[model samples]
Target: MMKIRDVGHAIWDRPLGRIVLLLVGGLVIAVTVMLYPPLRDVVQWFLPLGLIIWGGSRVYLYGRNDLLSLISGCLLILGGITRAVFQLIPLNELAGTVANLIPVVAIFSEMFAHHYREQE
Candidate 1:
């Protein structure tokens, strides 16, 4: 019979095993959050805040040297701020959708610009 410690070590040794474990942990947390109304509300409220932090960090780290990255990161930060503001203001769903799309479109445009510039 294998020892529990050995089994745990075996799981940690494989990349797939680690990924599966991380995914399972995330699923468990997601389900737990969904089960509680208050927790769900808290998560929703903070989600945009998380996005803002992520975007700001990206801008600070990568935007200094690359103008396109700066634009894309700024758009991401704007989208997060717009979402947070709309949550409190009771805006139309279309406004929120547009806000969410800004970062995605900016990123894609930046990528294409970089690709074309490199090809020249």
Candidate 2:
């Protein structure tokens, strides 16, 4: 039996295919938001929600890995939480996004530092 992941893999396994898929999906979402009007408010979550899920998994994995990585993952999770909360807390959207990005950028920097430590 072909699983959903296998079907997705078959369809989106190529670089061009992936880009086309993203463009098409985004277009569809854009059209839907244009049609519904109110959906634009709800649709703002696609990214931060994705980050929250990813960060949660990372936090769980890193909890067993090491202290620094666990801390970084916790920070990533916190960033996602703040981004979601900002939606309700009444801040400028661009400013909130930029502020949330700081933790993500710092986490990447820490990851790079970890990579260098491993290399040395």
Candidate 3:
């Protein structure tokens, strides 16, 4: 008897492919926000939320063995906490902003990983 193919492992293993797609997605969203003034601030806030949801979706799709999703979730949570803590710090603005976005990027990368894995 043949064993069932484990789709989750197949996709998450291709780290480079996932990273490329994530960079593309981030660029698209960033460019869109830059072009649209009204949506710019809102889009920035929504990115972290979107990343969290994307991570959850990966967990649901890939099951509990999804270490990538778990790590992404942790990074997102830490980023959120750091953002909140640094909100009052007027200095280091760029650092805080990048810190806030790290988890979002991580999750998107993981999601892309999962997506491409399924393709293979």
Best model per TM-score: 2
Q: How far is candidate 3 from the true structure (C-alpha RMSD, Å)?
A: 9.5
Error of 2 at 106 (Å): 6.6
Q: Where's the lowest-lDDT run of ten residues in candidate 2?
A: 109-118
Local distance difference test, per candidate?
A: 0.74, 0.74, 0.64
Decide which is better by lDDT, 1 or 3: 1
Query: Against the true structure, what is each candidate's TM-score?
Result: 0.60, 0.62, 0.42
Per-residue lDDT tens digits of candidate 1, residues 1-120? 999999988998999999998999889879989787678777777757766776777678767876766776676677678877877777677987776676567557556645754766
Backbone clash count, each prediction separately: 0, 0, 1
Off by over 4 Å in 2: 1-7, 66-72, 89-100, 103-120
**C-alpha positional error of residue 9 in candidate 2 after TM-score superposition, expressed in Å:** 2.3
- lDDT per residue as tens, model 2, 22-65: 99999999999999999887788765676667667666765576
